[model samples]
Target: MQTYPTGVAAKATGTPLTTLQRYLQRSHITLQPCDVPSRGCGENRGYSQRRIIQIALTTELARLGIGPSRAAKAAFEFSDKGNTGRPVGELYPLGQTLLVGLPDGKSVVINIPPDKSISDVLSNDSAAFICDCGYVVAKVLSNLSKS
Candidate 1:
């Protein structure tokens, strides 16, 4: 597993440095500890690729007006649900769009058979929101590489 420093992780996850700092302070997220802790202020801790993805998804939830803490919790649950091997981004087909239930703060990835659209399964006025896993994963990976 590749581990990224704070600045790189923040950039990779599209999370602001201060926001990551706040989460670390409250123990919402922890770094994959290093041999020598302090390389500098932002580089003191190292975050894993998994952690970066978690942060990125949390921001996805936050866009729905959910606060950071709640979003982080939901993201954590979604990412590591049941200690499952695959994370959220790869839970379904790479480009699959997931229908997220906001009420319970859980996500369900239903396999969309070929020739069927996601809209075919749910009504238009659904309280649920759709998430494009492919886009999210690509964005995070692309940024992670750049950073």
Candidate 2:
């Protein structure tokens, strides 16, 4: 498995290094370590690509109002809900995108269709505000589609 240094993960995920480190220290995530030699000539710790992606995804989700803890739990639930073998991308239009910023000083652009029902688009445990956004958007789209 590929691993990413703290900096690389921070850049890729649009998260600040300090925040990432705090999350790591809090045991909010498990990261894969890199194999590169330590630049400080001391103990080196690295993070895995999987962990980086998870962090990035979680961060992005939180920006959409899903708290970290709840986001983690929802991820597992969503994965299981999709066990019917249908890809999520296939279920929703891929081109619809949204730009979001997290409280942790991270920003990301994600693709999420305007057509998906609010209930289908967000995790059950998602923040109430997140569901509200989906509901508001869905209503707007429904009106537009009827025209």
Candidate 3:
């Protein structure tokens, strides 16, 4: 797996460094220790390609006026829901509502809006909001793994 330093990751994701650091602090996003040998007591950590993609997605979510708390959860959920071994960017154009695939092969459809919270969308009992993205992200990720 390719790893990126914080600076490089911030640049790659087009996120401000401080915002990225805040995301790292608030989210359960996985990170790895830098593989390079260090001479000092403190060793540098690195972000994997996975983490970089997550940051990029989170940045996009933030651009939609979503705060870090929800954005973090969304990022994690998107990653989990789209997991098929492909790059995370393959999951773009997430429909208004996302149908998350569960581990048991079942799915949970989540309705989302810029003005409403995710919890609020879930609590709304309207069938009109229920729809799937056709698992397009998942398929893209799967194809990426095959290649």
List the RMSD of every prediction in angstroms: 4.3, 11.6, 9.6
The digit string of per-residue lDDT tens for model 3 on 1-147 reads 555567776777678998887876775445534223234667666666556655665676567565656555555555444544333334433435464433333334354555676557656443222223334334333533443
Q: After aligning candidate 1 to the native by TM-score, how far in Å is the CA of 138 from where it should be? A: 0.5
lDDT of 3: 0.52
Q: Which candidate number would show the highest TM-score if scored against the true structure? A: 1
Assess each prediction's global lDDT (C-alpha) against the native: 0.63, 0.46, 0.52
Candidate No. with top lDDT: 1
Question: What TM-score, computed on C-alpha atoms, does each candidate reach?
Answer: 0.70, 0.47, 0.51
Model 1 stretches with alpha carbons more than 4 Å out = 30-43, 82-91, 94-99, 109-114, 120-128
lDDT of each residue in 45-88, candidate 2, tens digit only: 66554354456655656677666765533432222223233342
lDDT of 1 by residue, 55-86 (tens): 88777767877677766765665454532334
What C-alpha root-mean-square deviation, in Å, does candidate 2 show against the real structure? Answer: 11.6
Residue 100 in candidate 2, Cα distance off native in Å: 17
Clashing pairs in 2: 32-47, 32-48, 33-46
Give model 1's TM-score versus the native structure. Answer: 0.70
| Stretches of model 3 off by over 4 angstroms after superposition | 28-42, 80-147
